[model samples]
Target: MSTGKFIVIEGMEGAGKSSAIAVIESILNKQGIAYINTREPGGTPLAEALRDMVKSVEHQEKLTVETELLLMYASRSQLLANKILPALAAGKWVIGDRHDLSSRAYQGGGRGFEQSIMDTISDITLKGFRPDITLYLDIDPHIGLSRAKARGNLDRIELEQMDFFIRVHNKYRELAAQDKAIITIDAAQTMVQVHQDIEKVVIEFIAATDLD
Candidate 1:
């Protein structure tokens, strides 16, 4: 059997990543694909603890950008080592709700960390694991924040101001521009339309890769 595909959905807060993941899971189920749906910063027990530290609204000790970056990677390392790679080796598609892009966008762009620093952490922590395809849901920061607010219970990252999110969005665009493996989708469209677009992309990617 072929190696499993690693697909990730990424975006700023409240860009409907969770919804998109659900849609993707449904499609994968319909296709009888063995897949694992997971999220970064919390995929493993240790990683989940790290996620709480990173996202706790009350942990307002003002972490340095580099420190934040390191914590993110720490969680990622645990997740990849304990959950992601094993599933992939077992021929299960790993659909991640978020991935390394979140680090590049949030810590690198939003926090104004150097690209070299971000790259170093990613390289060291991930070794060579890269997503087969990354689906970026593009939405206006303001709109996304509004959606997030409607959902209530803002985490530390979600509580960040609009300016921070603008930076994050810009970084996402930059990363998408630089990488052929990343696909950006207009997320302002209705949920049905967004799901249709995502489905089309998944079909094309699977066909191009010749995955069973």
Candidate 2:
């Protein structure tokens, strides 16, 4: 079977990934593309369980940085092997809300872990698999946190210090700049503008890939 394309949307909290994904899904639907949607650290059943544990603030003791990193990858491994790869093998494009880039930003950047560790883990689990296109929503941390606050209670990771998210934002920019496939969108724009930017990228990708 022909492998399908992988598209991942990445961003800090309240960067409007959900809205961006909605636009992507609408575009793909209109294009009549077969696709599957998945989210990192919580796609498959096992991965969802891991997400709950990782995001839960009820843990009696602190969740170590190493533990957080391992759980994220464990969930990713399950999602990739069980859902993502198979969907692609069947010639279905995959839309991921978050992916390995989240680990690079959140764990490696936010937690101050070494990039070598992330590289080693990714090489072992993913064997260098990566998204064909990554749409990164860039937003200021202050604005993002304010939006997140309006939404509701914050998760464990969402409750992190401003400095952590600042690092994550910087890391996202750094990584996006290094990769031609990664497109950065100004997420601080109005919802209408954000959707417009997303549509433009999706349309361009569809045209370039020539997907039927």
Candidate 3:
């Protein structure tokens, strides 16, 4: 049997990543593909606990940017090692909501952390595993932030200032430019259009790689 594909959907807050993941899940189901849908910062049991800590608004005083970054990676590392890899090895497609690029953009770019520190942390946490393909949903920070605000209570990261999200969006663009496996998609489009674009990309990728 062929190895399962590792696909990731990444974006800033309220960029409709969750919606896109659902759409993709439906597509895979229709195609009769065995797949697992998951999210970073919280996938495995241990990781979910860490996610609570990371997302807690009550920890506003206690969480430093560096601490936040580390905790995110800790959760991610646990998820990848315990759940993501095992599923992939068993020939199941693994679709992730967010991945390492989020750290690079949020901590390294938005928080103004040193690139060396980000690189070191990423190297240790990720080891060598990289996503087979990443769909970067690019959206205006202003619009994204408004959507996030409407979604309800803000978490530690979601409560960050608009400027921070702008920086993160810029960084995402930079990373997308550097990585061939990353595809940038304009997310300002209507949800239906965005879903169509994502479906087209996934279908094209499968065809090109002969995944079917």
Task: Tell me the tens digit of each residue's lDDT in model 2 across 1-212.
Answer: 56789999999989999989989999999988999999988999999999998999999999999999999999999999999999998989999999999999999989988989889999988989999999999999999999999999999999999999999999999999999999999998999999999999989988988454
Measured on C-alpha atoms, candidate 3 has an lDDT of 0.90
Off by over 4 Å in 2: 210-212
In angstroms, give how far residue 144 of model 2 lies from its true place.
Answer: 0.4
Q: Candidates sorted by lDDT, descending order? A: 2, 3, 1
TM-score of each: 0.96, 0.98, 0.96
Say which candidate scores most in lDDT. 2
Which residue pairs show collisions in model 2?
none
Could you give candidate 1's per-residue lDDT for residues 1-212 as a string of tens digits?
Answer: 87788999999887999989988898888878899978878988899999888888776488666677888999999999898999998889999989999899989899999998888888999987899999999999999999999998999888888899999999999999999999999999999999999999998887787565
lDDT of 1: 0.89
lDDT of 3 by residue, 46-156 (tens): 999999998998864778777888899999999999889899888899999999999989988899988889889889988878999999999999999999999999888
TM-score-better candidate, 1 vs 3: 1
User: Candidate 3: how large is its RMSD?
Assistant: 1.3
